[model samples]
Target: MNIHLIAVPYDSAVRGWRMGAGPEALLRSGLEDHLRARGHHVATEIVEAPDDGPATEIRTAFVLAAALRDRVRTAREAGALAVVLAGNCGSALGTVAALAEDEPLVVWMDAHGDLNTPETSRSGFLDGMALAILTGHCWAPMAASLLPRPVAEDHVLLVGARDLDAGEQALLADSAIRLVHADAARAECRGCWTPHAR
Candidate 1:
């Protein structure tokens, strides 16, 4: 298998802080070497925020997402699996944009339900609205900038979500997106997996 690794080393709109360092940390931990040892061809690209960039978190997210979308598209054109190592969930928008042809099913595994919209969010955290953007719940202009295709709510499966705000909880209950609680996830996984007969 050929894998194209896209590294996003920024958290929210801020550069070089917090989760922003995760991608480089993973790379330093011999990720490339480990993948090569597993007999896969690997290529890497780093997506960085411009030195003079957007002033707001939302704008910054869109800028980075656009870059990631282009890179993902290029990777797909070259017949490589695009794997994004991102600092935040907002980057998922770019991944979805690149791959959402004929409405691809999205399996999102996150600690929080990242389904808050501008109207429902209390913390004012832009990253919290990433899933909403992907589902066309808000940020229509920014979402359309990358790609107009929005993953249908029914096609979204959110796993391992344990930290959700009241708004997020209410929204989840009303929406078609499937939720697999963190506690029950392991049991569900075990039930789904079966050993093949030799």
Candidate 2:
């Protein structure tokens, strides 16, 4: 299988993961070699932020968004079958928007539903509002980058989700996402000694 790895490296404003170290840790945890050993061609790229990139909160979103916009576009055009945009959901969402040109089938695998809009977001973190933007529920500026259209709410499925934020629950009720809570999705999979809970 062909894989394009787009790294996000943002950790919300949680005070632990915004440092861009997340990608390094994944590499250290054997992401590249393990995939190559399995006969997958894994192409790699990073969301390049300045060493002195803006440290302010909201501006950080645009800085990160600009970086991700370029990275995902460059990687998407490199000609891969599947692109893995992994890491902080904030940057990941921007990458997905950039890649919406591919007419993607987005499988959002996460613990939280990630369906919060900026207006509804109690936390005000971009990470929490990623799914809402992708669904085209809000975020006119960000969604505008996804030429032709945004990922349809119907085509964007969710799995491995056990928890739901209050905002997410409301959105899910009104939205068309094919949300499979972790247990049900696992139980529905065919013929595996151990189901892929992740």
lDDT of candidates 1 onward, in order: 0.89, 0.69
Regions more than 4 Å wrong, model 2: 1-4, 13-20, 33-43, 51-53, 80-85, 146-148, 190-198
| Per-candidate total of colliding backbone pairs | 0, 0
Q: What is the RMSD of candidate 2?
A: 3.8
Measured by lDDT, the strongest candidate is 1
Clashing pairs in 2: none
- Model 2: lDDT of residue 38: 91
In candidate 1, what are the lDDT values of residues 87-192, reduced to their tens digit? 9889998888888775789999999999999999998888899998898888987788887667899999999999999889988889999999998897778757
Instruction: State how far residue 9 of model 2 sits from its true place (Å).
Output: 2.2
Put down candidate 2 lDDT per residue, 53-100, tens digits, no spaces.
446554565466766766667765666654544456766556666767
Per-model TM values vs. the true structure: 0.90, 0.74
Model 1 spans with C-alpha error above 4 angstroms: 190-198
What RMSD, rounded to one decimal, does every model reach?
3.1, 3.8
Which 10 consecutive positions of candidate 1 have the poorest summed lDDT? 189-198
